[model samples]
Target: MGHVPTRLLSHPCATRSPPMKERKAIESWLTDMDGVLVHEGEPVPGAPEFVNRMKESGKPFLILTNNSIYTPRDLQARLYRMGFDVDENSIWTAALATAQFLADQRPGGTAYVIGEAGLTTAMHAAGYILTEFEPDYVVLGETRTYSFEAITKAIRLISAGSRFICTNPDATGPSNEGLLPAAGSVAAMISQATGVKPYFVGKPNPMMMRSALNAIGAHSETTAMIGDRMDTDVLCGLEAGLETILVLTGISSRLESETYPYRPSRIINSVADLIDEI
Candidate 1:
């Protein structure tokens, strides 16, 4: 990914403002998962309390993630193990957003998918059929293991007529071994083969943020997005017309974030700093 053009961010579809003078009290919260709350399966400092505060306040909130490999229930269980009592409904993934977008575009559509249970299950729940036969879409999502045969099939289907969709634009994912090839990497190969780039429905696209907001009946004016990355998290929040908070606990550093065309509404050390905000 490259630096976003300033004009593109200024499109009238959504509002992206410079740092605010005084803002409305945040009545709703949308926070990123990996960096803002947990990191490498462990809860970030003050993350659990922040989550508890959200729950206790009875305010609308959702934990967002680009990882489309695990279902919301699966993630909720994982968070519970780490002492964050987040409900499944309070978790949002790129898989859910992609599925929601597809369902809205073409109800009961058929798709050829290359992903794990998270993506497959969302597609199923959205009334989408999984097939190799003339699918309406060739959906790409995160998988623990990528199959050559599936990639070939996706390429062929896309070339033949299926529209291509990817869960996220992240080119790589973290692992115990360091980094691993992710959906975006595979999507690139498929796009190269078919000469058709995929439409991504994850962070930075604003669809993910908007879907979460809609799920909680949140209006942008009263909501705030807490994230750790300037690219995905902050961009998505800003485009969705939410106040954006950038934390330093993840991929983006204070210095690194300065390079982006737009700045987050505020920058803090971590979610710990926002506990009082709740």
Candidate 2:
């Protein structure tokens, strides 16, 4: 992560001038999980405080993640271990968003799922039957161990007329060993085989942001989106009509942000800086 320039704090988009009521309109928040809250299973500075403040303020908020390997309970426990007291209900995942999309599109449809517990559990909850034989869709999600056989099955299923859907567009994920191929990479392989591009239902896609907003019962115009990645979090937030805050605590840097056509509403060093605002 890079240092956020001080000038960015006073940028026009960073904060509304004068009328306190205008600033108070932003009562709810939607934040990316990995970069904004934690890194490598560790809590980012002041993340716990930020969350606690939101909870105490009686404002609705959600921790959003593109990673679909873990369920919300799983994430809650992980964050708890990192000393952040976030409830399971306060988390929104790509898995949940994808499942919601599927349920809305075809209410009781079957699907062949390729992912871990998070993805499977969401689909099952959404009333989607898991099957490999003539299913309605082929859903792809993040997993620690992606089997080649499963990929082959997904390719075949798509070729057999099943719609292709992916939880997120992240091509790689970090691990102790290094970077590993993630959901997007696997989706690419399947697309090459079946000549069908998957409809990604995660970050950088406004649908994901809208779903999260709905989960928290917050309207986009009155909510704030906090994230570290400009390409996904900031871009999606802007598209979803939410105020975007870019924190330089993960993949994006202050310098690189200038190159993007869309800019975040605010740029802070980390989630720590958000405590005073809350």
Candidate 3:
């Protein structure tokens, strides 16, 4: 299992590599983590095999997540416990994308961040100073505890000329008890108070996909994006010029997908349907 599938390679005699036209249309993959692979702390049916097949195909791939509360290593451990085998380097988060974006825009910048270790650590690695005194940006990300004081501070900082930036535009996040106010909901409040709109840096914004492509050294033309939602995942993949494959294991239903102005390249029942293609 650790080696590339034998069929992919050409044997000197009887067995030959697939002809150019017979080769997989997709050369690389970028897939959403939550709905496509797991749901409610459980691995989706055939999700683990799909991931393993992608790895065995000897293709470049990365697992993407909008949740910024956990770092790549943390998520890797979480997924490992849940039965998925993936390296930490194969994981990508909104926090990492946001940090990459900020680093490109202003290298050695300062920010007043309100989030957990994921966001703060990414900022630090990008050489961004986490401060409240005339910072360059007011960065916001997912957090288990969103204090009023932090929101108030972010509001004040944005009011005084700091640019507003959010990890993703999700208004609410899922929880065991119920829906919890996420970064987007708090961003709405801060925007209402200060009249400053935030620049979102996650799915539904193609920049994040582009960054992921660059991170994996893949080209959009040959890369395929596997996601479950038509709104964010599929839409972003479309905008990023990659082939989008939407699965029905999560949010968007086949009936719901018809309503979107743009459509995914293909829609399938689950990742199980895609294992052979990889």
Candidate 4:
């Protein structure tokens, strides 16, 4: 919605580095959907080219999104609506990863969800029974209609000793207007109610990264996790033993990197810069 920050490209960090070292075997890329490729529903600059270049080069890639609110089909349609030609199978959300984990842990068990239809649908499709009754697991994600009643129910089940699992830890997502509560907000509420920490299974979590790599059939050594969020995207890549590339076109600022222990393997201003480098 605003001008693309120029400092992201011409920042002091860029001058010190002799251009990004050539991309290491990056045969496959695991990319974040929201901030890395698009923002507030619009493709970031050079996003189409970046994706098309990968397609042209015959390198495989998948959109690894932490947002569990949307399914692969939903995301594919959204990308198409945004003018990007993306394959549906190339999309993987925290919802899918979380569902896979839950299915393995407690197959067919009832799950109490505090998120959107996508989370519920994925879990159900994965053979987990969806119920508002006392569930074995209380899963949390992005629920736009996250009301007091929903939180109350989730807290009740969690306090009753149900295993609490969160899709992600992101507190906010960008909008055309401003930032809004994300999946992590619901997770925080449940944690306060249950006095227990949730097992996060999204970006920054190796499980999510592992699932993406497995789906793309790429080795961690040859995989790249590209995103704009430092705490989630870059950190997840670092955890997965993959190369972490930080694009400043979204939430994180260059100065903020000094505060986190999760240092990115490389930092670029935007996906456009990545295109420029390639």
Candidate 5:
């Protein structure tokens, strides 16, 4: 991780080129879950205070995550345990976004799914039939256990002509044991076998950002996306035309962000620094 510059710490709003009124148009916010708010299932320092400030300010915001293993209710409960008081409605996951995409593209379609309750439940709620017999789509999502047999079945199904879809493109995820192969890694294996690339609906795709903004009834021009990773959060927010803030509390660092061609609208030490802005 790169060290945050002292200049950014001294002037939090220095990056905003727009005038005061235009800057004040930023009434909504979207934030990454893992690195921005929590680290390894624990709340980041001052994360709770920042969250409470958002609520008190009455600004529309959503806590976004690419992890598709857990539902909003599950995440809400987890955050509650971590000392943050976020409501389930204010949480959005890749699973929900994927389901929304499928429903829009192929309503009431059948799918062969390889995911846990979060993904499956959303698909079912969208009126999708989950099956293995010539399904309309082959959906992949994160799971605690990835079964070889399931992957084999997915490969066969995709080879047989089902459209391929994945929740996110994360190749690996952090775990207590260490880094573990995630949905993107497994998706690559399946893609290699069937010669078909799965369409990822998560961050860095920009679709996730658009969907999240719509969920909160926020306009991109008036919304700011706060994230830890430049490739995913900042990239997607930029693509979606939202102001992007990279907080140095997770994966990407201040120096690492410079390596990228694009730049965030602002950089802050952490979510802690944004409480005053709220």
Candidate 6:
């Protein structure tokens, strides 16, 4: 969240340097916190070192994620508790992105959200009205408990031509036990019930980039999207016109990379490798 640019001189033998040529010009980075930075509430391998490097360099970066269950404050505390010191404003969730989009598109419209209070609060704060009475849109995300009443209400609203807005399309996230169902699971069911596709506002969608750039004052040429998932993170950056780096840590393995639809600008073993490269 902090935006402080400090000067650093590259070695004389370095491949490139300022004034002579652009040294990649990576001014801002957008990264996923979970899986990439931490796994099971613990900092992932080399995460601490990578973050420390950023701090030392005074580089501007933000942690972005599709998980909408927690607020910025919640994530900030959790990361601090796990020994990763990050500013709360550096975290951007799908919920916040979706809410911001909705506010700009249809301010004060009613939303039938299928997520947690974090999402609801964001929507309301953004001038969106939360209601089950003939909602203007159906906002979908992960829900721990999908009650019969909730399904019925959403289906009823969907049948009435309420626009569907999905947070992210992730089907699962890693856990200590195993992979658990993610926000996209609920989005899939709702799409099936209403026979309507949703306007996704998470990864692979350019709106995420729009919001992230607005927050950090970065442009496509000067920003890098570093992530583990090619389908979402890498694709989002490519589609949004930003440089992308794929890391082999988290959800994507080497086998998965070969089958990815698009290729990343660069590939690294982890965020730590990014520190070495950039």
Best by lDDT: 5
Candidate 6: count the clashes. Answer: 0
RMSD of each: 8.0, 7.9, 11.4, 9.7, 7.9, 10.4
Clashing pairs in 6: none
| Model 4 per-residue lDDT at 207 | 95
Model 5 CA deviation exceeding 4 Å by range: 1-24
Per-residue C-alpha lDDT of model 3 across residues 196-266, encoded as one tens digit per residue: 99999999999999999999999998999999999899999999999999999999999999998999888
In model 3, which regions exceed 4 Å deviation? 1-24
User: What shift in Å separates residue 203 of candidate 6 from its native position after superposition?
Assistant: 0.9
Instruction: Write one digit per residue (lDDT tens) for candidate 2, span 115-150.
Output: 999999999999999999999999999988899999
Using alpha carbons, what is the TM-score of model 3?
Answer: 0.91
List residue ranges in candidate 2 displaced over 4 A. 1-24
Give the TM-score (vs. native) of candidate 5. 0.91
lDDT of 5 by residue, 25-83 (tens): 67999999999999987889999999999999999999999999998999999999999
> Against the hidden reference, what TM-scores do the models get?
0.92, 0.91, 0.91, 0.86, 0.91, 0.86
lDDT of 6 by residue, 1-278 (tens): 66533432335434464463343678888888776888667788888778777777777788998888888888888888877788888888889999999998998899898888668878988999888888889898766666668867877899898888988888886667887887777667777887888889988798988798888787877889888888888889889888888888777876788897678887888887777744
Indicate the TM-score of model 6.
0.86
lDDT of 1 by residue, 1-278 (tens): 99988988888654755653687899999999998899888999999999999999999999999889999999999999999988899999999999999999999999999999999999999999999999999999999989999999999999999999999999999999999999889999998999999999998899999999999999999999999999999999999999999999888999999899999998999988888877
What's model 3's overall lDDT?
Answer: 0.93
Model 4, TM vs. native? 0.86
Total clashing residue pairs per candidate?
0, 0, 0, 1, 0, 0
